[model samples]
Target: MAALISGAIDLGGTKIEARLFDHAANTQDMRRVPTPRDNFDSFLAALVGQIRWLEQVAGDPSLPVAISIAGLIDPRTGIATASNIPVSGRNLSRELGEALGRDLPLINDCMAFAYSEAHGGAGEGAATVLGLILGTGVGAGFVIRGDLPPRHAGLAVEIGHLGMPARALARHGLPIWPCGCGRDACNENYTSGTGLRRIAEWAGLSDPDPVHVAGRAATDPEAARVMEIWADLTGEMLYSAQLMLDPQVIVVGGGLSNIPGLPERLTGALKRLRLGQVSLPDIRIAAHGDSSGARGAALMAKAGKA
Candidate 1:
């Protein structure tokens, strides 16, 4: 018999990516296609096509699929509701599974990221893990002894929306910008790319992107100052999670995590607040980097974790 194959799709607003992974975490036929945001039929077709492609390449007739989405994916109902994706409030998994004749597992993107790291990535070997993304937004996924709950409704580790106290923002002299969620001064104001842009303005910057802010932090004193404030605010954010969940290891992913030396800086901030930490929990960058979503989707399919 041909080796059993596992597959996954990372569904994004702009693109849909499908990947196949062997038991060893090695990938094959990684493929990407435009997401048909306007039409649900087109979107489903894109996913099915990718699955067929991967199965053909691997010579497996029936490939199990698990998906990672940026928003809430309810495996029970197979419905998805994401802010950016147009297909909000639709039975994505159930409908897709009907088309494919199989019950597909679906997980939130953050959970997938966390599951990936927890199983074999940076968070490997840790009983409790926080898979955090410090990129366009600040969010996390919690894994308890490798169990990732599938029906989070996208709110389990949504750390970005938690507001930073006015007192905290006062220290950095940053303005209380309104969040997309209609709240003023949510954590996203200081921890997301938009937040980074706003923080950069405090250092007299204009429209600086996350990459620009991270790159200049090394050479420019003003930029360095902003990052310090960013780190402090972020530290505050992570500290709250530590107090609540007390994850054993934190694996940082996303665009901001790629900044050289940032992982160390974030580690220091978390450790400082750990309160006489007995061997501070490990904080490290994501080992699989951007591939965590797709890879984790496959893993969840193979393990039935979702």
Candidate 2:
């Protein structure tokens, strides 16, 4: 039988990526464009152009589309709520459907990561899997039995907003790690790439870049202090995850996941937090790097299920 073609959309704060994939989830073609500014119509138009490009490459206008986007979406209404992008609180699936003259499946970006990980990444063969993304923000998804994808109920696991004293200490209520969604301590304020910068500043180091600060942490005492705090906070978050789902594997993705020593530091912290005799959850960096979300979005398209 001929392989099926699928289209995937990854809507990030800074860019929107669309790609065409085959049944094996190999990306056949892809394009990425900067996310539009405040104009909603303009953003839609930009996305449409990307889709058109993918269509031209794959020669399949009727290709099944699966979407992954930052922020929260009401699974029932399919409305996307993103603060950084222009499409916040809008029903993206409905909008795309209206534009393309057909319905499209939309899932949270983190859920897509979990889906992809379950299929081929660290979560393979795991009954319960937890996917964690620490990028411009932090988010999570729980996959059961590696097949039954979790429903997008507007509440799978906004783990970033799990609340941390670090958030208030660093962001000081600024839009710095904004979480008006009313969750306390907001984990993103400390662990995200942006949040890590805040941690650096709080430690009296002036490096405004997360990558730079993480690098400095290796030699600079103050910067290392900041990382230690981040490690503790992240370890606590993982412990929370371990207690709740007892996932067989935890796949960590996003920009911060690439920072040197992050995996070991977080793992060591988790070891310190161990409860009586429970086996530590196997934790590892996502096999896919920063492109994990985009790739996962493509995988979602192939699966054709949310």
Candidate 3:
């Protein structure tokens, strides 16, 4: 008899990853592929290739697959809008089913991260979990107790697109940058990796990558100033979540979380921003790196079938 296996796939703007989970729910085999550059056909072909590669490694045709992807997933239509990737607005689930001769489950990438946190990661057993992805762009998802089957109307949160505080920008003397959402001064315009470059450029610094800027902050006052600006921007926006939802724990994920001093910088900023009677929630880096999405996607796939 073929062994039973479940899989999770996380597709982002730059890379795509697929992971297989063992019966014990431990991650087993993993595969990765570069995201397609442009157009739909090449994108679909790349995704199909990834599935085929996973199957080959597992040597089992009966396994189930789940996907966590960037973009808005329409709860009604099951359509996804991966605007950053070529596969935007495509019925990825249907298309994948056709190619693999089986159904594949899909969930928003940030939502998957949220699910992982709520179910098994940092947010486990917490009253409320606010999940954050601070990568190419900012994304958010949330979980509350007693919501059986865990379904939101497919639009829960998107913190990155929030308008940047004009006063903060002017105080720091940074030029405005454009966001994909056709807005100037959106939070993502200054907080994302690309956004970091724009901030550095405006500050007349040669380097803009958050990792490098973080390293330079201790020795260079300019880099420290840039980091302070980011901390302020992030902490200020995070306050919105605190006031609105009052989650017990806020989990931070994505590429930037890997930076060394990030946790200290962000937590200190949070402390500085807390107002009277608004209890500050515990903020920590997401335990899982990129794999959190895949793990949560796998869980979603299991729940969807159940």
Task: Find the candidate with the highest TM-score and give its number.
Answer: 1
Model 1: lowest-lDDT 10 consecutive positions: 147-156
* After superposition, candidate 1 runs with Cα above 4 Å error: 1-4, 149-154, 272-279
Residue 32, model 1: Cα distance from true site in angstroms: 0.4
Superpose all Cα atoms of candidate 1 onto the true structure and report the RMSD in Å to 1 decimal. Answer: 2.2
Candidate lDDT scores, in order, read 0.80, 0.75, 0.77
Tens digits of lDDT, candidate 2, 1-306: 146477788888888888777777766667889999788889988887877777667777776677777766787777778887788777877887788777767667888888778887878888888999988778998788865455646765777877664433453333334555655457777778777787677666877688887888878887777787778777878887888778888889888888887668888988987798789888878876655665676776666555
Clashing pairs in 2: 80-89, 163-184, 163-185, 163-186, 164-185
lDDT string, candidate 3, 57-114, tens digits: 7786656777788877676777777677786677777887898788777777887888
Candidate 3 lDDT (Cα, whole model)? 0.77
TM-score of each: 0.91, 0.88, 0.89
Mark the 10 consecutive residues where model 3 has the least summed lDDT. Answer: 146-155
List clash counts for every candidate, in order: 0, 5, 0
The global Cα lDDT (0 to 1) of model 1 is 0.80
